[model samples]
Target chain A: MTYCVGMMLEKGLVFMSDTRTNAGLDNISTFQKMKIWEQPGQGVITLMSAGNLATTQAVVSILDERTKAHDERDPSILAVPSMFQAARLIAKTLKDVIANHAQVGQRADSAFNATLILGGQIAGGPPRLFLIYPEGNFIEAGADTPFFQIGEMMYGRPILVRAYEPGLSFEEAMRLLLVSFDSTIKANLTVGLPLDFHFYETDSLEQGKTGRISADDPYFLAISQGWGEALKSALDQQPTFEF
Target chain B: MTYCVGMMLEKGLVFMSDTRTNAGLDNISTFQKMKIWEQPGQGVITLMSAGNLATTQAVVSILDERTKAHDERDPSILAVPSMFQAARLIAKTLKDVIANHAQVGQRADSAFNATLILGGQIAGGPPRLFLIYPEGNFIEAGADTPFFQIGEMMYGRPILVRAYEPGLSFEEAMRLLLVSFDSTIKANLTVGLPLDFHFYETDSLEQGKTGRISADDPYFLAISQGWGEALKSALDQQPTFEF
Candidate 1:
C-alpha cells in the first residue's frame, strides 16, 4: 500500500508520496512513487501513484520511453499540449497496462489496477491537477475540491479538510502535506518514509523544489512529534464535556 | 456505514457510536447502534455494533427477548456468570443470527455479517472489553491495547492513538470521543451526527451517563468548529519547511 497526495493551490501544485511497498507483511521494500517529466521553460508534469506497483511503473516507463523515442507511435507525456491531454495519456497508459496484465491470465483483475494523481503546467495553459482512475476516467481538482489523495487516505484526511487553504504558499503547503503523511505513517505500517515530494509553481512551466524525506529527516520528525502534542493541547483548550 | 469506539480507561469504560444507516447512498436512515443491558447493582453490558443492520438488530433483539423471558432454554446474556461469558454469549448469538440469514439464501455471505464491541463489568469481574468478530470468536482489550473501533474507523483513529490516556476522567474521555466522531462525520456523509455514547465507571455494576448528541448540540458545534481552528494553528506553530 502507498499514500500520496496532490494539492492545487493559488500558487501552484504540490505533490507528496510515500516510498513503502509490500507484497505481504513480511515482504516490504522502498520504491519512489513520484515521477516527474520536465521541459524547462516549456512544461512540467508530475505524477504520484498508489496501487499496484507493476502497473504504475509500466505506465511511467512507457511514458518515459515515448519521450526518448520521438518516432514511437505514442506521444510523450512531456510533449502533451495541455495538462488535460497529459492526464488522458497517463490514464490510457494505466488502463492499457492493467488490461495487458489481465490478458496474461492474472487471476484477479483488481490485482493490476492502479490510480494516479497528475499535476503540472504547460506553456500556454494554466496549472491543473487531476485524479486519474484505473478505468481511464479522470476528474480535475477545483475550488470545491482543491486536493486529491490516493491510497491509505482516511487517517490523514481530516487535517487536510480542516487546514487546506487555496492561498497557502508552497512552504506552508509542504508543511501541511508532511503532517498529513506523518499521521498516515503513524497509523499504518504499510505507509512509511522516506517520502518523495515535488512542487510546481504555477506558470513557471518547470518543476519547482523536489526532495526525498527519509525516516530520519529532522523536519518530518519535528512535525510528527509536534503535531501530537499540539493536538493534545488543542483538545485541552476545547470546552470540557459535562456529565 | 457507521463509526463506533470503545475504550478502557483507569476510572472506567467509554463507548461512542454514530447513528447513521444506509442501504444505498440514496436510501438513508437513522437507527441506534448502541444497546445496553443492565441489571442494576449486578452488572452492565453495553454493545455497539457495525455492519449489516439486520444482523445487528437481530442479535440485540434476541438478547433483549432472552432477558425478558426468564424461562428460555438458553441462558440470558444478563445471566452470564462473568464478563467473559457475556462476551461469548453475544458472539455466539451474532454468529447464529448471521448463519440463519445465510441459510435463508442471502447471495453474499458478507451481506449478513456484523461486528460488535462489548464492554462493561459483571459483579465478580473487573471492567472488560472485547471485539467480537462475525466468526463468533473475540479478542479482549488489555493494557497494551486499550481501545477498539469498528466500521469506518480509519479517519477518527489517529487522534485516539495520540490523545487517549488511561487516566482520563469520563468528561475528558467524552471530549476526546467527540473530537474523533467530529472528524469522522466531517469526512464521511455515511457517518453523521445525532451520535450516541455511554460511560461505565469501574465497579459501578450499572450503566453510567448516557446521551445522544444531535447535529445542533452546542458542545458538539463548539468542538467541531474549534478543532479546525486548533488544527490550523497547530500546523502554523510547527517548524516551517525550508524549501
Candidate 2:
C-alpha cells in the first residue's frame, strides 16, 4: 500500500509521495516513489508513482533512457513542445513496458500494475498535472477534481475534499496535505515516511520549493497533536444526549 | 455502501451508522441501518449493519423473530443467560440465516452478505461487543482494536486507528467517529446520513444515550469545519525549502 497525492493549485502544484511498499506485512521495504527529471532552467518534470514497484521502475528506466537519448537526439523534456505531449510520452512508455512484461507467460498478483502522476512545467506553458492510468491513456486534472491520489486514498479523502479550493494559501494547502497523509499512515501500515514534498509556483519558471518530512519531523508532530486535540474539542462541541 | 462503527469503551459503547444505500450512484435510497433491542434495565442491544441490505434485513428479522418466539417455543434476547450468550445467539442466527438462503436460487447474491456490530450489555456482565462476520463466528472488540467498522471502512479507518482509546470521552469518541465517517462519505458516494448515533455506558444498568444527527446538525458542522482548519494549520506549521 502507498499514499501519493498531487494537488494542482492556483499557486502551482504540490506533489507528495510516501516511501513504503510491501508485498505482504512480513515483506515490507522502503522505496522512494518520486522521480525527478530536470534540465534545470530548460524544463523540470517530477513523477510520483504508486502501485507495483517493479512495473514502475521499469517504466521509469524507459523514461530515463528516452530523456538521455533526447540530449543526443532532439525532443527532450527540454525539448517537448507541451506538458500534454510529455504526458503522452509517459503513457506510451508505461504501456510499452507493461505490454512487454505481459507478453511473457507470467504476471504478479493484481498488484503488478502502477499508477503515475506527472506534473511539470516547460519554460512557457502553465504548470500542469496529469494522472496516468495503468493503461496508456491519461486524464489531465480538471479544476473540479484538481487533486489526484493513488494508493491508500480513502483515509485522506475528506480532508482533501473539505479544504481544497483553487486559491488556498500554500501554507493552508500543505498543512491539509500533511493531515491527509497523517490520517493514512496511522490507519494503514503499508504507507510510511520520509515523505517527499514539493511546492511549485504558478509561474516561478524556476524549479520551486522542496521539503522532506520524516516520521519524526517537527511539522508532522504539530499537525498530529493539533488534529488529536481538535477532535477532542470538536467532540465536546457536539450536543450530547441524556443517558 | 454503508459506514457503521461500534466502539467498546470503558464507559460503555458507542455505535453510529449512516442511512444511505445505493445500487449505483444513480439509484440511491435512504434505509436506516441501526436496530435497537432495548429490554430496558435487563439488557440493551444495538445492531448496526453494513453490506447487502437484503442480507442485513434478513439477519435482523431472524434476530427479531427469536425474541418474538420467546413465548411457549423459545426465548432469544429475553432468555439469554448473558451478553456473551446474546452475541452467540446473533452469531448462530446469522449462520443459520445465511445457510438457509444459500440453497435458494433466487438469492444467489444473498450469500455475498452483510457484517454487523452487536454492542450492548445484559445486567450482571460487562458491556460486551462483537463484530459478527458473514460467517457464523464473531470476535469481541479488544483493547488493541477497540473499534469495529463495516462497509466503506477504509476512509474512516485511519482516523479510528489513531484516536481510539478505551478511555476517550463519549463526546470525544463521537467526534472521532464522525471525522472517520466524513472521510468515507467524501471518498465513496455510497455512505450518507441522517446518522444514527448511540452512546451506551458500561454497567449503566440498561438505559443508554442515543441521538439522531441530521445533515444540518450544528455540532457536526463545527467538527467538520474545525477539523479542516486544524488540518490546514498543521500543514502550515511545517518547515519548507532550505539552501
Best by DockQ: 1
lDDT of 1 by residue, A1-243 (tens): 999999999998999999999999999999999999999998999999999999999999999999888589468777788889998899999999999998886479498999999999999989999999999999999999999999999999999999999999998998999889989999999999999988888888777999999989888889989999999999998999887
Pairs of colliding residues, candidate 1 = none
**Chain A of model 2 scored by TM-score:** 0.92
Docking class of 1: high
Find the 10 residues in a row with the least total lDDT in model 1 chain A. Answer: A70-79
Model 1, range B1-243, lDDT digits (tens) per residue?
A: 999999999999999999999999999999999999999989999999999999999999999999998689368888888999999899999999998999877479489999999999989889999999999999999999999999999999999999999999998999999999999999999998899999999998878989899999999999999999988998899999887
* Candidate 1 local lDDT, residue B61: 94
Best by TM-score: 1
Q: Write the per-residue lDDT of candidate 2 for residues B170-233, one digit (tens) a residue.
A: 8777778877776676677888978898888887766577878888988777666666676555
lDDT of 2 by residue, A1-243 (tens): 899999998888888999998988899888889887777666778899988788899988777776777455444544687789889888887787777777786765555678899998887788889999888899989887899999988878876887788897677777778888888887788999878877877766666778678878776887777776665454454455222
